[model samples]
Target: MAEKIRLKVKCHACGYVMEGTSKYGKGNYHPEGLDFQFTAVGKLVDKAGNSRVKGEVTILCPNCETRNRFDI
Candidate 1:
């Protein structure tokens, strides 16, 4: 199996950390303090069968309700 892409984000406001993974053009973040998912727009995978999704995602922090921007 191909290795999953690991995602980690830290909130500058409350210092809360978010973690997730990207595989097959789908992104899934832990729902502990956040609930979110995104699908890659065009191509699902690259020539190597890896996720080809690349973009910016904005999410509100669950702890302080601060808006955080992330690049995936």
Candidate 2:
């Protein structure tokens, strides 16, 4: 099977780099509308040597070119 990928989505029309729920490095999933499912999260560290997860998110926009990320 192919490996999964993670990336920060770039809104083409608004140029928005979503911050929260986007503090990710890499992850995996099978997106056949939940026929299969899996997810993994990386570590996050702050300037103070602290860490906290921002969690996963799903965002949709109707007026722009926003699309679901593919694990390629």
Candidate 3:
């Protein structure tokens, strides 16, 4: 069974925090490449099958109204 995890993210620029659910990232194989959507919570897999969450996450800071990128 697949387990759902909660990803708690915080914005360094404005100290805004967001908590959401996440899952293993999956995409459709296309002629050009794999296609996926930008999700608040999902893992990214490389060609090697190694999967991991995106190291850098961009979110809109509610406090500052600025888009900030943060490292998890």
Best candidate (score: lDDT):
1
TM-score of each: 0.51, 0.29, 0.43
Q: lDDT for model 1, on a 0 to 1 scale?
A: 0.59
Put down candidate 1 lDDT per residue, 15-34, tens digits, no spaces.
99877665432344333334
- What candidate 1 gets wrong by more than 4 Å, as runs, is 1-6, 22-33, 37-51
State the C-alpha lDDT per candidate.
0.59, 0.41, 0.50
Clashes of each: 0, 0, 0
Task: Give the TM-score (vs. native) of candidate 3.
Answer: 0.43
TM-score of 1: 0.51
Poorly placed runs, candidate 2 (over 4 Å): 1-10, 13-40, 54-57, 68-72
For TM-score, candidate 1 versus 3, the one ahead is 1
Task: List residue ranges in candidate 3 displaced over 4 A.
Answer: 1-5, 28-51
lDDT for each residue of candidate 3 in 1-72, tens digit (9 for 90 to 100): 233434466767767676554444344211212121233355678999966655444556667776765555
Sort the predicted structures by TM-score, highest score first.
1, 3, 2
